[model samples]
Target: MNWKIIFCFTLLSMLETSSSSKIYNVDPSGYVLYCPCMGRFGNQADHFLGSLAFAKALDRTLALPPWVEYRYGEPKSVQVPFTTYFKIEPLESFHKVMPMEDFMEQIAPTVWPPGNRTVFCYMPRGNPDSESCNAKEGNPFGPFWDTFDVDFNRSVFYGPLNYDVIHHNMGDAWRDKYSSEDYPVLAFTGAPASFPVQEENRRLHRYLEWSDDIDQRAEEFIRNALPKGAFIGIHLRNGPDWERACEHIDSTPSLFAAAQCLGYRNEYGRATQEMCLPSRETILQQTRKAIKDYSAKSIFVASDSDHMIDELKKEFKRMNVSVHRMPNPVPQVDLAILGRSNYFIANCISSFSAFAKRERDIKGIPSGFWAFPQKPQNIQNSSSRSDEL
Candidate 1:
């Protein structure tokens, strides 16, 4: 027997087995992991819809990012897990779910390719002065998503070696180009606000169900605060920051209003005070009309200003109306209660209000913006007419 021949054949067989093992262990159905970059709860909701739609379109598993921790006095940060606020499905259903740390330490070395990777830079960039750059040219929803390259060490490349960037406004044509089997792992990042609002709402309803705790809290708040009948929900955004932002909307009505609050302006322009801040009288009138039109017995007011709520209470009292607010003052609780209302009135330029509106729309509840009529220069005296609710 030739021992040298046998030894060589055995070594060759071992190499073949090792190669086959590596090939078999690699995941064929890559995942679509995304990190939602900005915005609070509502903005994150919009991003969630975009990521979910992108994942579905490519037939990839969706990995959720941590929520943005917004402090009152401090800078905003993203350190909290998304599941901390909402109840997402278990990670077992997806291709993979892990913290950014786990992805870097364990998954990256295994999945990421040995060289540069593709990054779908979803952030839009162009000269502000040019109309052609500003217009939606390639994608209908604007230049929301673009592809670029970055080293594998970058945080955005949290998945496989080879990936495809699924930008916000890439359209159906781009999404149709790829499938789950095409890559070992795919990742997405950025706030995906360019997806269709209706489709976004539909996916949101399907994927991101509120946590049980949130649901219970909402139910309890509604039971304790609202009267036992069809009620009206109102989101009055009058925070100090909102006051300034409202002016932007008022001054640039052609740009902001026409763009549905999605467009940007380089300059801070001036507008009528009425356009920026709705007068207290305007709030009262709008609330009164909502209560009358809906035949609602109770009104749930969600606002950042407690003083405004107190003032509203006195006015509602004068009109023989019942007004209620959440005792805890949590945004999620307020949103849940508002969503359950029979009707809702919202500030047009508010994402928080928009969030509630989307939730209500999902339930087929009627809702409209609280259109404040411009104040007349001569009308300085307060009217004494009080309509009974």
Candidate 2:
């Protein structure tokens, strides 16, 4: 009987373990997680990771970044995770990330009562999209808020953890077009506030067991594929069919015409639709201006735009200009490719592109953004590409 119990315990531990080679000692500080989101546009971890960064940024006077570690019930509404991959008791939920709509907006501490490091709460798969990404069939967040009320949140909110920008460069004399609300100012010092980042970036080394050799191969892909010098990177990943994307390519005018079908709208004109993604020509033109403005810089490109890249290669060859492949190990096969470079030029609506270049990959505050003239800061902004860094 003892042998049976011992064997069962051993088997369960093996199954529950996060890995095979090395066991991860869960951090006592606990993990801040943003799970996959609604538009499901951002990565799975931003909500958590961004909170981590923002929390560190707050001074005594600053309100906490808009967040709640994963939790259960509230004044109303079922527990927050009835739809997400919220492992109750053993885990937590999150809050709906607040948008910075005004430059003068301020982040205040939780009116939601405080807890330290305890998982916050928020349901992900329901009403709007419903059971899409991490939802476990129907028990989204576990049937109801009443579940896990005893086990979870009982720990207490860490209030806010260490959150701040390790390094940040908002703007210089040349460019200062940011709005107040977009990134807004913090509580006390009133310096520009740090916003949310995905939990993925910081937890990456822990979640992913990518090998050093995998990283090496990804590096080779970039070295052999990219062009020389400081070039502008154009990342066009938002599309219906990845394979047929190249065929639809023409001048930027045509892409602008397709509009939403292209998976992006000119964000600045978010409510309207004036600044749709600049046509290919418009983007190239802007890129040229950006490059010229910041000389001694070369584009080291990397994106999922195979079709667009192939076309650029042909165009470069025809014009006798140099270009690089930039494409490397596919995201599905190798996650390490993300570790190669910290900078990017993202497409409007492609969360993959957004998730890739976001603070998760680079580990910083919302340093610089790139979007259209009327782009909404919640989703889009137009700062210099890598140059903004």
Candidate 3:
């Protein structure tokens, strides 16, 4: 055989061995990339007429795996890629990674010419034979694909994926695997349009769309922060951060304002503060005990009530407990964090308080009274008297 042919045979033989790590949990994944430029001029023209219909990006695409998957491929999870994204990119947003299968068809039903799908990328605009500078720097609009390592024309590690893991990719390290018959239907590299990503759309994209891409990441964080045996996420909506939550709780007249709930009284001759919005004193007492319970790690406060939080902390001088608050001021997605908790502690009156309970009911997570009126009947009677006055 020719020397070149003989050398090729030897390379294949060596590749089959050394790099085989025991593959256990195989995470399936695929791409869903898009950007403001590059998916659809259909050609590199200075005067292309038509709305830059990027949604048409998927017209040439196909379906995805039941669940998308991604390996860390490397350490270090991605931080907010853009600044001011704290608001633009919610904290809990990227922390979750899910299977691609979760979002099958997200296109709203009523849009005209009703054929669309998720993971839609931009259409190709440059010359098929060569990268067109016109496509790179088009007129009033912009380039068709301008969001990658263009500084160095070399291929990018994650931009419009060049290879699938299950499949072959010139024997590259980041190679992906895809079915023999499967291949990428579409790919693009750029920032998507400036249209406001609808609320529901953004939610679907973050938690549902990019989920599989970061599944390993989300799971690891969830596990490290909260081990999976059992947990009860008690949401306290609208409270200030911990320092503020504690300070607000300190101001309440009742030592256990939030604690004087209506459920069965404990050994201290007091009622449990399960779901009712009580005084800050109640929150203080319960917070301290939460530290000692060994039953629970931390309590989730979900309210926007700034004053109530610090007031509640005042009365809890005896117990050592820590409060974990989402760094965000206004949370867009209702906290599903509560349902993940072992049992729940909700405020009696507020709908926000019940968000956790509702999620628990849906997911079949068991929950119990975490707060209530200290004396339901008496409290009602007192309220009635006050009304008469």
Which model scores highest in TM-score?
1
Residue 338 lDDT, candidate 2, scale 0-100: 38
- In model 1, where do residues sit more than 4 Å from their true spots? 1-27, 73-78, 89-183, 192-207, 254-276, 372-389
Q: Which prediction has the highest lDDT against the true structure?
A: 1
lDDT minimum window of 10 residues, candidate 3? 380-389
In Å, residue 233's CA in model 3 sits off its true spot by 3.1
CA RMSD, predictions in order: 12.3, 15.7, 18.8
RMSD of 1: 12.3
lDDT to native, each model: 0.53, 0.32, 0.31
lDDT of residue 250 for candidate 1: 38
C-alpha TM-score for every candidate: 0.64, 0.40, 0.30
Question: Which structure is stronger by lDDT: 2 or 3?
Answer: 2
**Candidate 1: minimum summed lDDT over ten consecutive residues — where?**
380-389
Task: Name the runs in model 3 displaced over 4 angstroms.
Answer: 1-232, 237-276, 287-294, 305-320, 329-334, 368-389
Clashes (candidate 1): 3
Off by over 4 Å in 2: 1-18, 21-41, 48-135, 138-214, 241-276, 290-306, 314-320, 326-329, 332-344, 348-350, 356-389
